[model samples]
Structure formats: C-alpha cells, structure tokens
Target: MIKEQGLSVQHVCQSMSIGPTAVRRWVEQYDSEQAGQPGIGKPLTPEQQRIRQLEQENRQLRGDVEILKKGVGLLCPRAEMSFRLIDELQTKAIPVSQSCRVLGVSRSGFYEAKRRAAAPVVCKASVHLRAAFVASHQSYGSRRMVAELSNRGIAAGRFKVRRLMRQAGLKPVWKRKFIHTTDSKHDLPIAANVLARQFNPAAPNKAYVSDITYVRTGAGWLYLAVVIDLFSRKVVGWAMAPSMPAKLVCDALHMAVQQRRPGEGLIVHSDRGSQYASAQYQAKLASHGFICSMSRKGNCWDNAVAERFFLNLKMERVWQREYANHAEAKIDIAAYIVGFYNSERLHSVLGNLSPSVYERNMAAKKPIVVSEFT
Candidate 1:
C-alpha cells in the first residue's frame, strides 16, 4: 500500500510541528509498510486501436449536424451564401466569431439572414427605393422619394418609401439652419414700407424683391445680390462681388431691367441698407422707372420672398460646397440657379412645377391687361 501510494507513514514523523500526541497514534496505525506493484493494463491489438480512433472521429462529425440544420433554415441569396460558408467553417470546432473575422462578414449580417429567412419575401420595392436614394445623392426624403418612384411608374406611397428607407438604412443629407446676414444699419433716406409681404404677385414684372446674402470662401467673404420676380419666385438677376457696395445692387437691377424690359411703375422691394438707399442705386431705379419699396426697421418678413430665395440657395447648394474663391462660387451657383433650380427643381407652391414652367403655365391661363398705372 505504501509503495502504490508512493511513500507514506513516516511523512507524519517529519512534521513534528503537529504535536507528537495527535500524530503519534496516526504513526502507530500506519507503522507497517506493505509494498504493492503499480498496475498496468494489457495492450490492445492494432486493429482494436484503429476502431477506437474511428469512433472518436465519428462522434466529432456527428456534432456538426446542428450547424447543418441551421444552414438549412438560412435565407437563400448570394449574401446568405457567404454566411452559409461561414457556418460550415464554424462546424469544424472553429469559433463563429473567428469565422466571421476570417470571412469579413459582420455578425449582424449573419443574424439578418436568419431574420429574412423567417419571413421569406422578395423586397423589390426596397431595391428601387435604395436606387433612387443613391441616385439623388441621398437628398430626397420620403415625400420626394414617393414622387420619384411614381415618376418611374413604380407604385409606392410615402409611408412605404419611409419604411423601405429605414430597412435599407438610407437617409438624406440634413440641411443646416439658415442664418440672417442682412446689415440694415445705415443713415439714408429710406422708402415707405409698401410691398409689405405681398409675395403673391398678380403678374410677372409687377413687383420684384432684392436681398443680399454672405458666402464664406477660402479667400474671404463673398456677397451675392439677387433680384427675384415675385410672381414665380424666380431669380431674374444676380450679381456676386467681394464687397457689398451700391454698385453691386445696381448691377443686379440693371440685369433684371435688360432681361425683362418690365413696364413702368415696377415696385422693387428691399431692406434698408445703404446700398439700396444710395443715390447711385436710386438713380438707376429711377432711370428704369422702378418704384422703390423698403422693409421697416429689422423686418425680414417684408422682403420674405427674397429672403426665402437666399435660404433655398444656401440650403440646396452653397452649404454643400467649399469654394476656394468668389469665382468658383459664382460658376457653380450660377449653374444651380439657371440649370437646376429655376429650370428643373419642383416647387410645391408652384404646384410641383419649375419656376420657368410655372410662369409659362400662368401666362397661358391669364389674359393680358393694360398696365395699372396707365
């Protein structure tokens, strides 16, 4: 017993720290040393050993049946095929996380495949919504996407488009808040508040609104002066300059006059700025027989049409770009105003028609009348 246990009995004698009285009886009981040989099993034949190895391998291969069942229930597509291959690798005692890392598949994708398989419906609508969203530079929201899909002859409502947008993880670029940059602080002879938020014009050229907005550039600040026809809310003329001088406003008004050749008594509305109140600008307006109308002190709503135009310009174009200088901004902004905004973009107030289209439609609808002043 002592030999099989590999030494004993006298071990207690070596530990005298335990009092002799307590260990003395234990030593006396184990005093007799009975030796016994270590046991060894009989060796198995080579054939039996091979059989045992095969049984162990069979057990391991049978363990993969669970992974096989999961693969059977996964969604069928090229995306799921990738995950299916990952699952097969996982059955080989490989960690699922490790297989995901090796195959470059997110765990979310693996889980999403299982979810889709449970429902098993084709998502053609989501595909079209995703395509439209990508094509618009991700600028169209659910409402605009609904319109775009309808134009493509795909029947989809706003709510369905919104749902598909969420499913596809698609969202449009957000517009930053608009800032007021008009500086109306100047001592000059101002005109009476006549236009007074009367944005709905009876006809084109009856009234025009003007305003100035600032744009940041790498070089410095760039000022843009715009004159808009109140009837269609279209930018009739615009001028970009490094400084906001009276000549800036005059140049834009000059362009509007040259292009439209409006009848006499055209009321031009603007904020109370020195540029608009300057003798030079007043002389130019007088030369064209334009009646000057100014907004009251610090009242932006009086020139709301012009202010809205600037807001559209910034939110739709300028905010998305970083111009190196005024020249670059001029080219791009001119393209947006002429090529896109006025010609192609739809306005809800214009009944989803572009400004040019709306003007033509209005002209077709209304009969001509003599000038009010005449």
Candidate 2:
C-alpha cells in the first residue's frame, strides 16, 4: 500500500500501526524485488519468491545428486563394502541415513555395519576365527578356537567365539564312533604294562606311544601307524601301509628312533595288538635297548593319546574326504599329520601349542640330548 500510494515512511508506520524500522525494511524489500535485485528479507513479489524457492530446491537437488554420485561410485556388490563407503562419507559430514537411502541400503544395516567396524577386535576376531577354523580343517570347537585366537594375540572369549562362529556358520565336523583295529587274540607274547598310565613324561623320548588305525579307500583299507612322544604329544614318527603287519609297527618305531634317538630303557608303549606283540616288533625294541610296554587286554585308555590322535585324524580329515585309492589316502593323511597336526594344529594338552612349537620351545629351555644308538 505504501509503495503504490507514495506515502512517507513515518506516515505509513503511523497508518499501518507498524514500527518505523519494519515499515522501512518492507519498503526497501519491495523496491529491491521490483527492481529484480536481491535483498536480505523475504521477496515480496511472486516471481522473486518463486525464483528463491526454485534456487533452494535446485541446491537441495544438487546435494542429493552429489550424494547419489558418491554412493553409486563407491557401491559394491557386497552390502558390507558399501556400508564401509557410507561410513567414510559420514566422516566427511554426509548424513548416514541419506547415503543409505540413496544407496538403497537399510539404515539399520548401515548402523550395524558401523557398530561392527567400531569394534576392531571383533572384526579381527572374526577373521582369525575363520582362518583358524579353516586351518584346523574345520575341526576346532569354540574352546580351541579361543585358544588359537589367543595364540595370535587376539583376545576372544569362548562365548564370543561361539557367537561369532555361529554368526559365520562355522560348524566343526562331528565325530563318528571309533573302530577298534586291535586284534589281541594272537599267541604272541605281550609286553607288561611297564609304562603304566604315565602318559605325560618329563623329557621328550623318555616314553613313546604307538597305535594303528585303518583308513577306507576304494582299493582297500590302508593302515597307518604313528608314534607320539609322551612329552610333547608330537607325532615323532608315522608309517602307512596297505597291510597291518609286524613290520608296519616296526617301521613306525624305526622312524621314531631315527627322529628321536632316546637313551636306553626308554619306554615304548602300545596296545596288545598282534603287530605290537610280534617277535619282529619285540626284536626291534630290544635291538635299540628300549623297554616294551603294552596296554592291558581290551583296555584302550592305556594308550588313550594314540587313540585320541586317530579319532582326531578321522574326524578332522579322513572323514571329510573321499579317498579313491591307498595312494590318495596316504598322501592326504601324511599331509594332515605333517602339515597340519604337527606344525599347525593346536594341542590342548600342550597348552594350545602345535607339537613342533611345543618341542621347539621346550628344547630351547632345556636342550634335548640326542642319545647315540646306531
């Protein structure tokens, strides 16, 4: 009304019942709008107001486009990877919900990803858990998995390991019933249980346990004999053959002697199987000045360590694979014993250390004496 009537500012203020400053400011805004010039206050003209609205909308659209561009450019097939990108953008002042919306990701999922990333320990634990599980041939339970993580300097509790394992779908292989391969009905003289139930020895090569287990193959059953040192629970010797004969146990013991030449009177314990009680096996022990000890008839606990090893072998590797022939079974079983069991597998008895590592650590503390036995 003031602009069209050409009234003075003081007159307009008194007539309109508005303050002098308000009247003046509205007049200046109107003048600027009419002249198509920008002003500090809201535009009075419809065209100017429309322009201002469109400019604001354009700016908002540009921002949305920029966000979409970043989201699309960084987006991957995996949601986790995309969430990481969104997290990066968030640090640069981008709203997480906006980025998630543009990327077609749920806000909750993005936040979950953020929460996981916040815990580097959990992330690292997840990685180490999978690796340790795979490295263990999917045979490690939550307890051993936690120990493996601890060995790697990653602190993870059993419950946490179990949770992460369940989340990752890391289920260990189930164990089947153990098959008894020992035939104790033979006429061969059995050695007395001299070693008794003393499974843990103070020194390596002081006592050794041997056992034989059969593996199924297309060709036939392949027998495997292993000699474990009582001190380190290490497979000091192992031999595989298509037949379970006296020579098989002898060969395993021979390998054990070659690897660890124990002093005289070292106890060599085994179940009262015919192969173990055979004259050939007895002669082998006598030649090396070793004492022979046999488990009581039908008693498996006397050589429980060896039985446990066989159980582990079947559960972890043999049962998981299909062997076409003796050669295949032999190769795979050898790999499991050497590559995985002795070198990498965690032994609960040995404080979660691999057999090789336990031996090496112990040998360092007290150098193992290699006895001369030609």
Candidate 3:
C-alpha cells in the first residue's frame, strides 16, 4: 500500500506503527560520518560551511581536469597553427618527448593533427570568400554574398558560400531608417555654385569637399565638419562644434587650408546651405584662392560625394560605438580619423589601400606637388 501511494520511509514506518530507533541506528553505522556534516540535531558551524565549500570546489576542479584530458585526447586538427608548432619542435634545447609530455598532449595525437595533407586549393579559396562574408555583416543573402565572395578571388559558387554562411550562422545587418539630417533651409546666404557638380580630381589638393553632420551622445548632440581631399579621400581638416553654423564649416575649411595650403584654382564643393553661402565662408575660400561650388537646389545628388563620405563615416564607426558625451565622442572620432581610418583602413575604391598610403604613393609619383598634413 505504501509503495502504491508513494509514501516515504518515515511515513510508512509511522503507518505500520514501527519505531524509527532501529533505522536510525542502522543509518548511523552504515552511512559515512561526514554525511551533510551536521550529525543528528547539531547545527552546522561557519567552519563546517567553509569545509563544504572547499570540498565542492575541489570536486569541480577534478571534473574540469577530466574534461580537459578528454579534449586533449580528441585533438582536432588546426592546419597552419600545427605546422608552426612542428617547425619549432626540435629547434629548442628540450627533448621532443619531454616537450610533448610537458605540453600534456600525446606525441601520436600531436602528429595526427600536424601531418601535412594535400592543401584544399578550393577550400582555401572558400576561406577568403568566408572572410568577406564575415565582414559584410554576415547577413548577405546567398546570392549577393556569393557574388561578393567570388569577386574576391574565391572560386566558390553562391550555393557554397550560402551553405558556409548558414553553417557559421552569419547574416547581414537589418536595413534601418536612412536618416537625412542635413537640412539646408536656414535663412543664411548660400554660396554660389562653383563646383558645378564636378567631383573628379586629377591630383591631390585639386578639389576638396566639405560637409556637416550630427552625432548623438548621452548628453545631447555634437556637430562635426570635415574637409576631405578628393584625390585620396583623406580628411585634411576637421572641426567639432556644439552647433551647426557658418563658423562650424568655416573652422574646418581653415584647418584644411592651413594644413594643405592648396593653391588657387582648387574647387571647394558643398551643399547650398546658408553656412556655405555666407559671405564669411565664401571670403575664406576666396582668400585661399579656392573656387567655391554649391550643389543645385533641392538636389542632394549634386553633393553626392560629400554626402557619401558622411554616410560611410556614420556606418563604419559612429553607429558601432557608444559615447557617454560629446567630449568622449570627439576623442574617439579624432583617433578613428588620424590613427585608423587615414593610416590603416583599406578602401576598396582606392585599390584596397589606406587613404594615407594612396596619398603617399601619388605624391611619390608626382614629386612636384607640395602639400603637408597637420
């Protein structure tokens, strides 16, 4: 009956009118003295709690060691990394056998993972494709991602890259609202259309583009203006101000002129915003011998290149980083431009070379051009 009803031993004993003394004596003798460590009615002391904790930690450590041993036994192969290890195998003074023992890996297991096999001429190609997939938000649909992979010297078709991306759990970023924040309707005087939508530059400092964009911080907003050299896409001059005004754009232009000292006939292009049209802004450009240019009314495409630069700047950096305030953002933006974007980051349009590198290469070819970066 007790078994059918799921009664515990204590309840079954009471129902059967049997004393628990005998069961208690049996437990005391058969069970370990350390069972729960409180013995009979005694309460556990702090020292006992500490002992229990230590025992649990020791057991966990033992389990971890066992798992590691199993993993070492399995020893999955890692191609190039294993080759490097083998090359260094006998170069050191220590015996290889002892070194293997110290490394906690069996010699046979190490060799198994290290043995050279026929290179996957095709698979290596897939890896390069995979890297592009990984970099492109991993969200590229099979066809586009595959096209991108194939374009980058990988021989794999769309199906293969798609399968690889799925296996690796990659996906491109979701499309978000395209924020159009540069408003040109202010009552300020507009600069005359000097660039006339001509963006092509034959050499460095021949044409420059300038624009203002807003960055959001925890405290509020920060406005940044940049003047980029059209020849190499380098940001020659930049300024950050609390508000967007004629002074904000002017400050950036001043810095660029000071650093590059672009001679007369240089084309400076921007939107037909009041700031750019202001007499002060036009005078500054005129004093530097730059021909001021403005985009056509209500046409963002007229200043498309400048707008594109801002889009890239936001997408590649500001969108990914968190800033506590304007000051923090300023510091990071400076580092991004001077330390990474100009000096290191590769641009596909610029033949996969950094802006600074492209500029340097161009300068080398045309030694007559005189320009300096501050």
lDDT of 3 by residue, 76-142 (tens): 3443444445448668765657656544656776565544343235556556656765554333467
TM-score of each: 0.61, 0.68, 0.57
Over 1-374, each residue of candidate 2 has an lDDT whose tens digit, in order, gives 68687788998778779899987787787777565567655534877668877877898998988887676766567888778778788899999887786777799988777776666656668988898899888999999998888888888789999999999999999868656788998888878999898988988889999999999889998999999999988898989998898999999998988878788989999999999989899888898899999998888899999999998999999999989999999899898988988999988888889989999999999888877877
Best by lDDT: 2
List the global CA lDDT of all models.
0.77, 0.87, 0.72
Q: Per-residue lDDT for 246 in model 3?
A: 82
Top of the candidates by TM-score: 2
Better of 1 and 2 by TM-score: 2
| Decoy 2 TM-score against native | 0.68
Error at 215, model 2, angstroms: 0.0
- Which consecutive 10 residues in model 3 have the weakest lDDT in total? 113-122
Cα RMSD (Å) between model 3 and the true structure?
A: 21.8
User: In candidate 3, which residue ranges exceed 4 Å CA deviation?
Assistant: 1-166, 171-183, 186-189, 371-374
* Per-prediction tally of clashes: 0, 0, 8
